[model samples]
Target: MFFVILLAQTVIGQKITGTVYDDTKTPLPGANVYVKGTSKGTTTDFDGKYEIEIDAKHQVLVFSFIGYKTKEVKVKGKTIVNVTLEQDSATLDEVVVVGMAESRMMKREHVVGYSIARIPQNTESYAAIKENDFKDVIKNPLSTFSVDVDKASYSNVRRYINNGGLPPADAVRIEEMINYFNYDYKAPKDDAPFSINTELSACPWNKDNLLLHVGLQGKKIPMDDLPPSNIVFLLDVSGSMNSPNKLPLLKSSLKLLLESLRPKDRVAIVVYAGSSGLVLPSTSCKDKKTIIEALEGLSAGGSTAGGEGLKLAYKIANENFIKKGNNRIVMATDGDFNVGLSSNSEMERLITEEREKGIAISVLGFGMGNYKDDKMEIIADKGNGNYAYIDNLLEARKVLVSEFGGTMYTIAKDVKFQLEFNPVHVSKYRLVGYENRLLNEEDFEDDTKDAGEIGAGHTVTALYEIIPSKNNSDKENRLRYQTSELTSQALESNDLITLKLRYKKPEKNKSLLIEQSVQNKPVAFTETSDNYRFSASVAEFGMLLRDSKYLGTATWKSAYMLAKDAKGSDEEGYRGEMIRLIKSAELLSSNKQE
Candidate 1:
């Protein structure tokens, strides 16, 4: 009898194995499988096969994948349990709405009324981005662009990689990817809002050219010293946000942010769907339970009236304006604005006008299919605010809790950079990213012109790939009428470039100018600081992803190696995560080739 009992226990301890498939019986790779009610989980391999050890106590298993409905199975003494998840019809119907907008002449009201159970979902959304091209320094000597502190692109790209796919080329914004990782630049010493650091080194991808890295470090503000905040949460509880990863994830994300709020801070809730309404009046942070209940009670329904919601949110913020304190509106949505003032230009005008009234807007993007990335980006850019995409709960914590100061407080506004390359030293150059943020040469000195804003404790980095004047291979043809000779002063100067920065204090209208010159001294790549090396690695990675024509010899292997070596003092493990992401991307690329 003892031997029989031992044999039964051994048989029961065997691992449970199964395959996950879609409705058409096609295997789903990278699907998440785990024991229900626990963190123990494993992802399906390339063949969609998963194995998990089930103990006597854990009898339930859950299977989930992006764009598919989740499935839960009870073991019930079964050894093998296969799951066939149905395509999430809701997301698919929304994809139709995105593509059929003009063809069906469907307005917001008609589209919102379509049932989610109509189709099978298949689509990816990304803002259209036009890459920058190299310019002759002799003709276009100055490069000017606003500083973008938004890190949405980095996390959004990661979401694609983690789901076993490569991000759309336009989605890979190199500057955001590099700025997502904080650098160890020196802090500001005097009354200046930020300090600038510049480094020039031999380009890793092309040994013939040089790479110039410019970094800006914003002054750090301790959490306790931050001003009291008067915040309005503009949430989108529209019908489209009914997915598990949309509304539910947003609620959980906001709760994490609430944990970091102080008693002196006050928050109000404004929701939009069909029409706009105030869900919770301005209440002190000490009333955490009431705020949480308000967030929980929000349900998805009706068409989205994002413009009305924004108007109401700004009105509340203006009413409760905190002098010398942080008065901001946090707009959380999927960026699908279908009602009044839904056009991009109209939304931009609304947010820009409201921002001028001292209430900044920070946009938190959620969801995937039917996501309006272009609209979200424009709203943040025009509203004197920042934008971040919350793809998962962990990213939520990073943006809202870990970097609260940087996300909520604006230290500098209309920050701009203009680099004047010496015609004698550089022949041609290209700014790695910021294609959309480029400013006119005259716009740098215009205080009234809108530009990017830097939050407290935020760091912005920009890179320029330069071809020296001696490199005749990449030079532009000399004009027949104009002289090709450099000026006597340009020939005599030792300066390679002049970096000019213009920024306005958070409340001031006028701008302050700071100028610095960098000498033409290129250091070996290995001797450069970890900040320079790591940023170069990220830029190279982006170029490879974009299939850039300027990518002379950049490869995924080289980028991965460089990033892995220069990951110094990665306290937050963000750098380490980049290394892993590169590996996955490399594998995906190779698989495509095969």
Candidate 2:
């Protein structure tokens, strides 16, 4: 049949192949691969093998992917073109959360380490404990929150946290990671081969918190700067969203999301109360009168049929889907799928299938008291989407309006980080966080495995604490059958940790690599680094709160202290809010105990 011949040709195009890896040697699951200059791509299976046939018209094939580098190969249709993707040192442009105006030195001009005091450094006595130790910590995607704080041998964790020794009085803080940035970075406009911009801020919630903002603009690629977006605001007006912070705050936050859409982009307001019903169908983005009217009509009262609502929203999106345009479904809810196909797994399945059909999901979580943090995180992770918590309206703008590229576009998918310690330079190392994103060492080289995605301008940061072999005075565990023994001549740790990142472009399947390094001695604590400091602070805060086994952290008090001390030239109000959050968390913890 004519159809059969077409299918054969489709399968016979030039074949290009490659392997992928995280900083560690693990096969990343669900990574995507495809040829450049074409719309054909396939995802890496569990084993990470991919082969797609493309025309050999231009023997040279361009391979691109998210998180990794973009490689161009001049192949007379080579069957195997193995590639190793590196990490991207540049970060995306987004609203950098610096502590708020509370600590804002408006009149004072900014300098690298201005208004910063040197850290009083003294090693903790407990640091003299047995060299290699292990501890426990719970982890998952999106975020980590736990009720039980202590259940493992922190061992030197306290020593790791304490500046000298004793309980921590400061929380190693970074507000930018906590807040996410406000703008998506754009490539450079000049012809100067390379360009870069960096930002720094203190925590907004805790006095000790600090936020760093890093931006890297690549060579400008001419593309249409489309007007706003045709966003469909879908609200779940169900009984489960009855909490004061849930539905009520959600209403207020939705108002902020609305502000981002312009009249040029079409927007429709949809809400699901007792059953699925269209409060307002598709409308113009500029028609605020119609939009607000529909939004105000929404209220909480009735069982939720989330499935029905989602189906209807997708219908509307498909009908109004913009080809080569940002057509998105913004879902705001507590993630209670009680009414229909409500299970987290069910929602994930539905969203996964929908992503291939071209509709994207953006989840904005509201409230605190009874919010489903885990459920929310999963839905976002599996849905090929971005998820954020909008505790207030200001946060709503940050997620909905501010950073669009880092938020909406998919630059790479199934991003996994892995690293291999050179026997000559390293002994033992511990990845700071990402307990959930870990992969087997073998998986790193497997290009077909699925991992995480990097947004258009987003920056992924992972830190590891390593102990040098020379510094380690412990017995070595030797491997059997090998001529070499660990005791013979163990290599020391690298003075710097080599950072490796891999990714696939939204339209292509083949992956590329980018790499950079971080010195173990670390930059001066008081020095200015908008991106690293903010990300570092977030990692510290997450560890402390979750009671991490290897945490260099503690209670809210110390967390706040670290953020405060790290406060640098924080033009953004992120750091200020971190201070407030510390105070709020302290109070919340107090009230819970009572």
TM-score of each: 0.82, 0.59
The worst-scoring run of ten residues by lDDT in candidate 2 lies at 143-152
lDDT of each: 0.82, 0.49
Error of 2 at 575 (Å): 0.7
Which pairs clash inside model 1? 92-121
lDDT of 1 by residue, 447-564 (tens): 8899999888999999999888884333445689766666677779878999999999988999999999999998888799999999998998888777888788888889988997
**Regions more than 4 Å wrong, model 1:** 1-33, 36-55, 59-125, 471-477, 480-485
